[model samples]
Target: MPVLSGAEPFAHDGSEDIGVLLCHGFTSTPQSMRAWGEHLAAEGCTVRCPRLPGHGTRWQDLNQTAWRDWYDTVDAEFDELRGRCRSVFVFGQSMGGTLALRLAQQHPDIAGIVLVNPSVTTLRRAARLLPVLCRVVPAASGITGDIAKPDGFELAYDRLPLRAMASLQQLWRVVRGELGQVRQPLLLFRSNTDHVVEPVNSAIVLDEVRSSDLTEVVLTDSFHVATLDHDAPTVFSGSVEFLQRIHRERAEEVV
Candidate 1:
């Protein structure tokens, strides 16, 4: 599983004690979140965007790995950031958002969470048969590059491995059931015309999370890959504002 050129992981050491951990979606690379991480880094925030195992590589290799591998990678990164930074927040897109939510459930001490077009359920009817279907075939057509931004590629494999996708479905079920345990502040950005994930998934998350400080922003001109789409600036600037607002509130509480 040789990593691609643009799919390498990104880490930035900002001057601020605050840190941000960015997680890209399933079948996608750190390239998907590079701009957002760099934007946060420019704002003096320490940012780490790790490429998930088997990702940024080949889809066939991804079939051999499960969701636990991906979760462990991000969890280890979060633990490392927790040790170095005064306050650490997590940002995730699509399946990465599901991972972020799981991290929050395990660690309520986290500063906050930011999610974009997170996927927690299956909108595709065929996904339901994954458990049985994966045994029959190893791969399927990928659903990447669902962006309105011209020439925007996800730097992902053209094939989607059914085994890995089945594992993802299991992860979604676990995270969805534990949504109520999420107590940290939440900022979610949903794209209006997302082709990959449905809006109902976001609606379910909003209804279940117990976070008192919750905000949802709708992107009117973007698709599933909004971080690289027309409204990417919205996600970038809005996340900064979210972080600043939460930082201030925590400061006020201490005062």
Candidate 2:
């Protein structure tokens, strides 16, 4: 399948000492994360952002994919980064955050993790009907492009695929159950007024994760897609700082 014009996956080989794996949200393309990846690369960090399966092509294609497919893609990228760099970090936006957490849980060597408006659970009442709706409804209104900036946009599908979302919910359950296994340093960015994911999602992550190094920055100006919104610089800069701090700490421990 041909990727959308701006949705192709991107990579930057900046340094062998540090690598960052970026993951975009469900139904969204790598375009949403390209700028952030470039920022990390500018800071001398090797960066990679992979296009998740069933994304950046057609919404219907997502229906044929499961959450495991998305996780597998990022997992492979993480392994490749780990092989190339002395230390590796994982950054994720939305469902991508869920995958990041799962990676940390599964891989004890992840240097750290960063998240933007990650979704672990939703308060939407309609979600209760997904089990049945996915059987009858193929798609619903998309929850994309929630940027507060006037010109900011995410390359995402306009329709939400039911089966894919159902698979995502299953992934949430698995991640939440294994939160205690995620002990890596963590930084999370949450939008104060997100239209897609609620604040409770971040709260759940901070509360449940076993990471002793935890930080949260509230985004006052952005919505769900803070990585592309007015507070994008905050997300980008803060992530770089977090990576530096974690790398320093790891170096000290090694010394």
Candidate 3:
């Protein structure tokens, strides 16, 4: 059992061949993924949710980080999982999902991907004014309006980081360009009332990916943060089933 460092803010008991590495969305902490990781761990799998750079701390801390640093954080976590598990699965929420997609493209060791309200594409209106808005906006918190936060978690800031938003736009551009290359099995969850990523992003994944096996669940009862919302149990059970099926298939292949 490899002990994860608190600097990463992850909870892992041991190394298991079947491992799941979870990434939380931008402006969020691994705490968001903690419940799902615990649920999965109870089902006899090793699970980890690592805090990305600039997360689990102050919002200004994130403003200093770039996409590469964020990606590298997840990448290191993925590498650790690869070392311990015979097969690995990756999942993420919102911006984290964007990182998962990038990882799935590059890591053949990854067996599957689960995306929860992933921000595959930037907000539509923002996409048009990305260049100017990114510069115009200042580093602050990311929460706004009546955004219902996950229980017990406070957003690092109340305003969005302009440069980080710009980086997201750029990351989406990269993911969009490489969409066809993501051939891993996929499980996509999207909220019907999501105020963030557009619905069409999930539709794009359903349409463009060449993967023969894909499943999508529409969370009718939740808002953007479905993993921690009313439909969270559904999210947990469905994801565990998906991971189990993939694990079984791999086990049979080895036999």
Candidate 4:
């Protein structure tokens, strides 16, 4: 399948010994994380943002994919980054965050993790019916472009593939169950007024993750897609600062 023009995956090999793997959300493409990846690259961090298995092509393609397929893509990228850098970090937005957490659970050596409005569970009554609804319906209304900035937009599918969504729910259950295994340093950026993901999602993560170093920043000016919204600068800069602090602490430990 031909990748979309702007949704293509991207990579940067930096001079620094830090590697960062970025993951975009469900039904979204690497385009959502492109700016953030570039920012990290400019800061001398090696960066890789891979297009998720079913994303960036068409909505129908997603229906044929499962959560494992998406994880395999990022998992391979993480291995590549680990092989090339002295330290590595994982950054994710929305469902991307769920994948990041799964990575941390499986790889104890990940330097740290950064998440933006990560979703592990939803309070929607309809979600309970995904297992059955997905079998009957092929797709549903899209949950994209939830940005507070009028001009901000994500290059994502306009429709939600039901089977893919059901798979995502399965992924959420697995991640939430293993949250205690995530022991790396963590930074989470959450929107104060997100229309897509509810506040309970972040609350559940903070409470369940066993990470000793956990920090959360609330974005008052953005919605679900905070990466491309008004507080994007805050998300970008704060992530850099968090990464630097983790790197510095590791260096001091080696001294």
Worst 10 residues of 2 by lDDT: 123-132
User: On TM-score, who's better, 3 or 4?
Assistant: 4
Q: Could you tell me every candidate's TM-score relative to the true structure?
A: 0.98, 0.99, 0.90, 0.99
Please give me the total number of clashing residue pairs in predicted model 4: 0
Segments of candidate 2 deviating more than 4 angstroms: none
Q: lDDT (CA) for every model shown?
A: 0.93, 0.94, 0.78, 0.95
Worst 10 residues of 4 by lDDT: 11-20
Candidate 4: misplaced stretches above 4 Å? Answer: none
| Residue-wise C-alpha lDDT for candidate 2, range 83-139, written one tens digit per residue | 999999999999999999999999999999999989999888999899789998999
TM-score, prediction 2: 0.99
Error in Å for residue 247 of model 2: 0.6
Error of 3 at 154 (Å): 5.5
Query: Could you say which candidate leads in lDDT?
Result: 4
Residue pairs in steric clash, candidate 1?
A: none
Give the local distance difference test score of model 1.
0.93
